[model samples]
Target: MGYSPSVHKFAEGADVPVPLDLELVRAVLEPHDVGDPRLCFDPDGDLQFWIRAGDGSEAEIFAGDTGILVERPHSGGVFGIVAELVSRLGAVAVDPSEGRIVCSTEEYAHLPVSMRKDAVVIEMTGERLEAALLGRRPA
Candidate 1:
């Protein structure tokens, strides 16, 4: 719903603030067409949150203690929302498919072609890291 169809934040996991500030993300997103965010879970029940877009569909913004993963197919005039979030959150826009961290849409026309394919692995890796930090088992 933004410049890129899919964007992975916290490309560099070590750089995030410990006890990640959930409010910081809320603040950055509140001004947009999205509504309030609330705790959400998949059928598998991995912890995350969801924000409802104006269209009443869930926005792809996935918030975790360590990173945020967003993947969307439709464009709802939410352009540049991702850029602002990245800027305000100090989160890196990593396109592993491109083998680089993308800072702006101008850097390339294609942001990620393989992220959807690789997200499960990347997220699983993050789960281990998060589990270590929280002193808990990864679900």
Candidate 2:
């Protein structure tokens, strides 16, 4: 099934906090005519689709397989847990913001020289990643 009409309507040239819907991602990239049908993982171990269009262009889109991975920025302890989880899942942690988990097959390819305080920039697309930073721990 495709994304709800409301979801498409909401996504129309807008950025919002919506769980990664597999169907919607497929529909959104089909028009692009990218590559062959393939599945990949994001930074969070969530499933994603890789479409190989006619022109051989490739598009990577998130599939909402995994539910809300991390609501807020993860702390050292929590972050370690996530890391371990990904490792066990046979994936790697990409970004905490999007909760991008990817397989070893998918290399980082590139990464920013440094992530800014409270800001993450996707090295590939050069887009700023926004996610709530891990909150302070109580004394």
Candidate 3:
């Protein structure tokens, strides 16, 4: 089974956190129309949808106020698309499988990070990555 990776949202050009929701993702992708964002509604705070790649392959997007999760990404181009997608949202794509930020080497160098037990910790919260997503460790 393919694992899910997630994006961390922050203020534009800044490290301050921001809300990540379906509306924000829709707004970022509406004009480009690069992929079809399936629309649905739920009173629950979280939602999921399909994000297609240029090659017609797709992945699932789980979006909520806390964060966005992407799974079963089969296309190479999806990473490129994701980079652009997150950039538009002032966020970063993190690959939990790789335990590193999905970014260029130079960009990765500048991220505020710490290594703990071979785990990459985002200094933003000093949290360990869980299921390829950043999560705070139990206190």
Candidate 4:
């Protein structure tokens, strides 16, 4: 009964540009009353943060060159908060449940056709994540 979040990165290198403004992202998400915002970096060099939502739900967010990855609880308005964050940051939400993508930013329209058709499926492995981001069937 929860939702999974993922980001689409089109570039394949170490110098990918991060699309989100961390300051602004923090400002917008602050209203959600996030607690213990621990900032860190992923192995891929993505900026990441872990926070506890107002409702005590834990979430992890990773800001990367391609887009932002958000993992939040599905309850207690987490979905609404995610939508607002995506809109403010000019990102998109992939709805695996609906087998479609929810575009929240203008950039969504400019994304490549391959990305446009990408669906977000929840999986725990790196290969699955790679496949999902690449718009390819998971092997």
Candidate 5:
């Protein structure tokens, strides 16, 4: 994981092609290192994914492994902002050549977007998003 943007893909709730600012994503994620395997679980069990990173590591995100997942303790605006960013990023990174891409819930909807796909909510809240990616499992 030598910070190759072209080596990544994004998939959201749509089938259309979308361009992403890899630099932006990198800026958001570059501060952390790849570590743990995070999980997202939707009520309907329709969507799932994880992010792996660690201290001083680049974050790697993945989706579509669980049901319609939603993280808790989030308000409408925050959720929307995060969903927008994640879905936008996902849409860009998802490879149509491999399979289908879905957004599931629209931005601002009740969709869950983990700060880091690999770590637990505690780790995310504790500012350990980067540590989790470095293969550090949450206690």
Candidate 6:
């Protein structure tokens, strides 16, 4: 099967709370030995982490108030990593092609019923990063 990249979108509301525990996140990544993950802030002030995979490819996970943005090269193991995160962190997978939430965890059982309209949109781009560092949105 070909690899399909998807973003794990955390739903907002009283029922589906976003996981903000960075230590838990680090713990989940420990088994993979992702090294000492570096934390950074995005343009919108969301927390992000840079993790080095076993194969040395860099994978980025941006933790927003309501969701997480994962950016990885077309490497083979990203899907598994995402799955692991879903299993450990209770994330909902949003299929990139369909632009909808496809799966839910036990903690987010209400997700499937929530529909696509509720899925949070998270965009991570180099221009956004540059603008954030410069303290201005790119024109």
TM-score of each: 0.44, 0.24, 0.58, 0.53, 0.26, 0.53
In model 5, which runs have C-alpha deviations exceeding 4 angstroms? 1-16, 33-85, 88-98, 107-139
* lDDT of every model, 2 decimals: 0.43, 0.31, 0.53, 0.53, 0.29, 0.50
* Order of models, best TM-score first: 3, 4, 6, 1, 5, 2
Q: Any runs in candidate 4 off by more than 4 Å, and if so which?
A: 1-3, 8-18, 37-47, 51-58, 95-100, 104-108, 117-139
Question: What global local distance difference test value does model 6 have?
Answer: 0.50
- Model 2 lDDT tens row, 9-94: 11122333224455544444445423344434556665544433343433333435433233332122333333333333332234
RMSD of 1: 13.5
RMSD to the true structure for each prediction, in A, is 13.5, 15.9, 9.1, 9.3, 15.0, 11.6
Error of 3 at 99 (Å): 2.7
- lDDT tens per residue, model 4, 31-69: 554445444655776666665555565566766666676
Q: Mind giving the per-residue lDDT tens digits that candidate 5 earns over 12-86?
A: 423223344545543443333133323333464322333223222222332232211222212222222233435
Model 1 residue runs over 4 Å out of place are 1-19, 33-58, 73-76, 104-139
Q: Select the stronger candidate by lDDT from 3 and 5.
A: 3
Q: Give the C-alpha miss distance for residue 36 in model 3, angstroms.
A: 9.9
Candidate 6 clashes: the total is 0
Count of backbone collisions within predicted model 1: 0
Task: Give the Cα RMSD of candidate 6.
Answer: 11.6
Separate clash counts for every candidate: 0, 18, 0, 0, 47, 0
lDDT of 3 by residue, 110-137 (tens): 3444422233433221112232243325
Model 3 clash tally, residue pairs? 0
